[model samples]
Target: MNAPYSRDCGPPPWAGSGGAPSPRPRRVPWLSTLLVAVLVLAGSGFAAKGQPDRERLDAYALALLLLGTALLLARNRWPVASLVGTVATALVYLGAGYPYGPVCTPTAVAAFTVVVAGGLRAALWIGGGFLAGHALIGHWLYQYLPPTGDPGVPWGREVVFAAWVAAVLTASELVRVRREAWARERLERAAAAKRRADQERLRIARELHDVLAHSISVINVQAGVGLALLDSDPEQARTALTTIKAASKEALGEVRQVLDSLRTPGDAPRSPAPGLDRLPELVEQAAGAGLNVTVETVGVRRPLPPGTDLAAFRIVQEGLTNVVRHSGSRVARVRIGYEAGRVVLRVDDDGPATGSDAGGSGNGLAGMRERAAALGGTIDASHRDDGGFRVRADLPAPVKETV
Candidate 1:
């Protein structure tokens, strides 16, 4: 709900206000007393044979009047209790010659309270009770007061009073419902934002885990090999050192790619996202890491969408990482081909693996599959019969424009 009232008014114990601000102040004890005083003055103004019955509303009537008025101040917070007090005061006022002053105000407020708190049904029943008690007692008073020729209680006055009470109650209820609806909408928006944030975090987490885990794993192995061969075979050690350098550089580039995603506004443009054009560099990096990385492209090629191209690049990068980490031999094949209505990619390695070697647990494969599916494509992953792993992705080819 919109914020509640900022301050306390009069600090009256009867003010039952909390949560959102009420249309009226929480406590109006002084207002209630003033209203009661006005009602007493008005009742005292009623004429009996050319002179006002100023003494008719004595101490008893005045006490009932004040009690009923006080109840009005607490109607919102303690609706049922205030309603009971108003009803009882109405009876007392009627028995004591109909104090028309503050008598009706408290009952009217109580009826309104029921309506706003309990909807139309409560308003209807409470209003009906009010009218019945008031009309019955008013008719009795007319008979007992020795007719002052003021014409009996007109039906229009009761109708007008009921209409005024109903209008106030309904308007308050409508405002309450609208406020609640706005609050619910705000809550739904917050929940949706939280869900989107969580999904984004998971996407970034998977990308970092695949890139860093796979890249650093290769660097670690190459470093170990180079350290072992430092004395007997200096040439092979040199080659291992060279491979380590290339892997470290590629790893740094991949890290930079990840960091660029977090740039603030007005920052310089990042390195362009890797796509098909960077396939040659990717293959060379893998070849330097001791895996035979090869590339073959066919058909008429055109510029692909960034998302599609990025997906293709990551699939290749991850597949090559897998080959070096899983397979023991140096020969891994890469293939990229464009054909009718589709672009196909495949990476297979026929390298020998020792008993301790294990292929990936399939997170990278799943990420590739998800990316391909997002573009209305598919992917397949399985082990080759030649004792190696194969990763394949098929992406729908965008129709090229004939310029």
Candidate 2:
């Protein structure tokens, strides 16, 4: 059976795979080309002595230098092929007694490219092959030719050559690992930013739903009452119309506050976020909408973190909105309790679940739950055994001394 493909280990999506042609490689950098050229020209000056003709030796050295430079240009596009060519050319130049110093430069550069493109395994194999070839060839040459200088290629010198190749391979591998790590970090940052944006969008949607749905439901009921009393009693109709006008105006102001916050610059003026201080206004609004609401507070009042305060207010707003819209109750009660390290809110209604209620699919309860969770709080909402719905929330806060 074929091995399964792992996305984590694969190349980036833009890099085609599965036999498809990969994207064109980037052009060779000018700095790299210049470096290669410099190495080749420097190598050409070190032609070995005792050639049959001095001029012919110089020409052969020039030809090898040009070939190495040309091969280096294609290193990135076909790194393995270019590496092989470079190593082979260097070995041939050295074998032909064209001096050893400059010839090794191209081989070192090729070893680096092999490691960077094909990883350490490729570098090890290619480097080992070159080392073996050099040892064999040097042994053969020393056996046949008479010694020109001291110690005929000391073993220490061969050790140094192997070390140079190993150093280049190690450096290339370090760079490749760092580049991959940077790419992975960038991907993670992008994913995190996307998640935050999604959460913000959901929160804003919930705010709009609670604001609009509650106000519209009240306006709709008052408008019907006005229409009905218009024929019998003008005074009551006027009162109903006035109530609708007030509810609409208040809703508009609240909606504008939300929208302005979204559009305003960070340093721009912004309206204060609603909190428990606005609970009385909310209760009055519900009373105007024909639902009797009473609010009770226990324990001492204290300041809260801005986030916790806003979340607390929203939970209360959502709970009361659900009572007004979903529960077919004439009276609702809101109870707020302040404790040593937390604040609690409980909104209960005299509900006998009506078939007209929007039911469990509504976003109001979900929004309340989300708000509480975001503030490291907890919320519970369910129908009571005594024939009413209850929403209870507990939010963390710092303990403050009573004034």
Candidate 3:
């Protein structure tokens, strides 16, 4: 799966300071930084308006405001601490009777900081504290400091300003939260795509493994027998040579498909998958491997349901392969029949029994059973009292109505 954005696409617009790509629950610092910048500009502009006699504009006031604005940059990272520091410094300026510069710019950064990190609840409390502090200072100036330069308000405007502050904080935080949600969605889609790719690769691996694993095992056995009999028995050697040739051909075809998968973008487009019609070829291969494979038809061999054909084909193929590998039996029988709205396949071996072969836990039988169950069918496998291993599968074949 690809990353959310390509290298050519670049990072999103909201990416914050430190070039941190948008995180889920976006921790973007730009909006917060903009808020601080605006407040700094506004405060600087307001402070510039009421200059103390140019002679009295000292180094101390310049030092405090510059330090406060610089501190605001760290707001998102340490909201509570930054807010506390900004609030403390603002209080000192306000206490000096709204001295010659914009005193509330630092407060704007503090208020916005609380909203972004701590959310609306924190904003409410922090905004309330700011307003309360201003009202108290305003009242103090009116009552004792002899009213410095027309600070006018009927209490309602103060309430409205407080509401505006809350709205701006909430709106900015909402933007960050939404960007985070979008990042999460993109990440989830990427993960889901990766999982699907992995599962498909595993399925292809299983198919390639089942196809060549069994065929090569047969070829190995026959090649060894052919080498042993080359000097002692010419006819037997020749027969084994023929078996090796047939196994090699089948293995080569299966390997070609496996390698083709790597070159193809995904599943290769080719002929349809092998199905019931190909069962005869599989049986012939087994027969060539020196197994006397007999096939019988007990019911109508009509066109089967689409999915049923492939399932039936794999059942027969695996069954015959198992017989070749595990059954020391020289003779095997395959019976295909239709009865009671279902198709049945029964492959059994009647030969000398090797205890290891007869007593084995067979994944071939298990896979057939699973396929049968998925089709609303059934499967049964057992060793007969007559010393034969049998596999039976019943697949539903509901007749289609003529159109």
Highest lDDT scorer: 2
Superposition TM-score, candidate 3 onto the true structure: 0.71
Q: Candidate 3, which segments miss by more than 4 Å at Cα? A: 1-43, 50-61, 90-124, 138-149, 264-268, 296-312, 335-346, 350-387, 392-403
Q: Give lDDT for model 3.
A: 0.63
Best by TM-score: 2
Per-candidate Cα lDDT values, in order, are: 0.65, 0.69, 0.63
Model 3 Cα lDDT, one tens digit per residue, 113-230: 5565546676667667766776665554534542255343347645655665555566657755876688799999999999988856754655565566557656756777789999
Model 2 regions more than 4 Å off: 1-39, 42-63, 142-151, 261-265, 357-361, 400-403
lDDT of 1 by residue, 1-403 (tens): 0111110001122222221224564554455445544653354344211233222656776677777767766766777777778777766665455323334555555655665565557666666676676566555565554324323355665666566556656665776678678879999999999988776776676667666766676677778778999998899999888888877887788778777766784676477777889878777767666667767777777777787888888888888877777777677777888877778889888856554544455577778887788789899988878878888999987866788
- Give the candidate order by descending lDDT: 2, 1, 3
Clashes of each: 0, 0, 4
Mind sharing the TM-score for model 1? 0.72
TM-score of every candidate: 0.72, 0.81, 0.71
Q: Write the per-residue lDDT of candidate 2 for residues 29-101, one digit (tens) a residue.
A: 4466556566556534533332222123457766876786568677767777777887787666655554434
Clash-forming residue pairs, model 1: none
